[model samples]
Target: MTPALPRFPHGPGSRYTARAAFSRTRPNRQVRNINLAPLVQRLTERDQWLAWMLHEHRVLTTQQIARLTFPSIRTAQRRLRILYEYALLDSFRPLVQSGSSPEHYTLGPAGAAFLAAQAGCDTAELGWRPSHTGRIAYSPALGHDLGTNELLTLLAARARTTPAQLPLWLSERSCVRRWGDLVRPDAYAHWCDDGWREMPFFLEYDTGSENVARVEAKLASYAAFTAATGTRPALLFHTRTASREAALRRRLAEPARNLDLHVATASADFTTDTPWGPWWLPLHTPTRRLPLAELASRWPELSPAYRPQASDDADSALGLPVPPLPPSDQASRP
Candidate 1:
């Protein structure tokens, strides 16, 4: 029974033996594959485009990308997922109406790289435009803009009329630091004494649509500003809206009285008088082309009076005590 060739071993002509032989050699025939970095690099480029798109735009949804002119919707969506997988994009899925998807994406590190690489691309270039209003004209650190230039011109002109007018105290645009929750007033001025002293005044440009809550918050901000700098700053609110202007005046008068601080309003027309020492004074901004210089001309007198000292001796520079800031928030000057 053991003889007779093991009963023709399954399939025809010993196919079973042939398969076993091939299986034993198959392990030796295997080839090793390497070089995954190039594949990863190619994937990264796709993610880079998605990142760039997100970095430049605001609150874009998946559906929005499908309709954009640059990339086909499917491609955009696929690429966005790649970016998400790579952590190059940050996504937020807010709760909305039932059946509504609240997914939104923004640029992450990879997106920022794409933004930097694409010359002159920033939050502004991506269509997140800030209105021209509320922009500061000049700060030595933040640099000068039209608003800063205009304000300086007005300040320079006003200094010339006073019998006790001091020289124009000027802090150039570069002197302030820029960062964090800190704010540097648009300009630091003085009744120009040769000391180039700092009369702490913060100029805020408001373009209306700012509500009561905003005003209150800003009042708190003023309180914070004074606390950080150790000086009572005159907040010069500028606005084109008459209603907002009037409301600001009313709000400031009450809170300022409570806090023993001063907040005033002005307009671009230069005709609106700025209040001084609780007395409404008709102020004039000089018409000269070189206003700061004209303001500086009086520097001999003004700088000496308003000059800032590092002595850490004086209690209050503005002659009024600043209200203590709230416990949770601290103000810092930049």
Candidate 2:
């Protein structure tokens, strides 16, 4: 959290107008609890556009903010200019990146005040509602498929067995907050155990393996997370290649020991039981594409010991067959 800016004291003659509002308490250095979901739901596209502007707070490039939000780079740039002219966003430009001209935009003080007020609310009632471009909004539907309630349920369930705390990655600012810029995780999670165990997990959602640079960068990021959190989190990768997985872990292990991670594949050296059932499971399945809602409905039937004949193939439905690991790696990795 950044230090609170100085506030002017109320003068004896100062009087509030109908449109003006005043804060009763001084701003705390710590983040005051607020319901972000309702705040986000109260916003519209215009609000998002404006909020994105404030994210940089007068220092981000237009191109950068666009890339962060819109579908395409060109579209992001175009819309950004429009927002600026309409007084919704502020921009400054002709800067350099690797020696090229670029435009930067950010939220003005007016925008900042607006967001701060919204941020000040009851923590218990507020929740995170993420936007389509992956920003936290204030609404019931924080993100697309996984609404706020659904997320709470799934997170609560994961909390039961996973021995690590679950920290949220609501924004880049959050990364800066917990770990500082020099050392921070992709997301922060501190297990809410008796001792309040804190572990920062590195999350990588891979769609395909084309971006070598990105993968390498994330590995470096994990290094930072480990240094800041004082413990290595379970490296969680959604879907990735065996070779890629091995190489990344190998690189990560050099810097940090006591590392524990989970990568789901069709075959592995370990057979673990889950809420789903007890069986040797692949990280990725070949055919079980059941939607999560359907899975929730039929969750009663699935136990650690339960396995369906349909899931008989060790390579169930993740597209690849479970390949037997060579005796060496299997024994090493759990």
Off by over 4 Å in 2: 1-46, 49-78, 86-88, 97-99, 120-169, 175-183, 186-251, 254-257, 261-334
lDDT of each: 0.38, 0.33
Task: Give candidate 1's TM-score.
Answer: 0.33
TM-score of each: 0.33, 0.31
Taking the tens digit of each residue's C-alpha lDDT, what string does model 1 give over 168-190?
Answer: 33322222422125544444444
Q: Best-fitting candidate, measured by lDDT?
A: 1
For candidate 2, write residues 1-334 as lDDT tens digits.
Answer: 2222222132211111011111122222222342334444444554454453344222344443433334466876766655444333444332112354344344532334335454453222222111111221111111111221122223333433344223232222344543455543333222232233232234343323235455545556555554554554444443223455445544444333332222222111121112112221223221443222232222222211111244443341211111111122223332
RMSD of 1: 26.1
| Reference-based TM-score, model 2 | 0.31
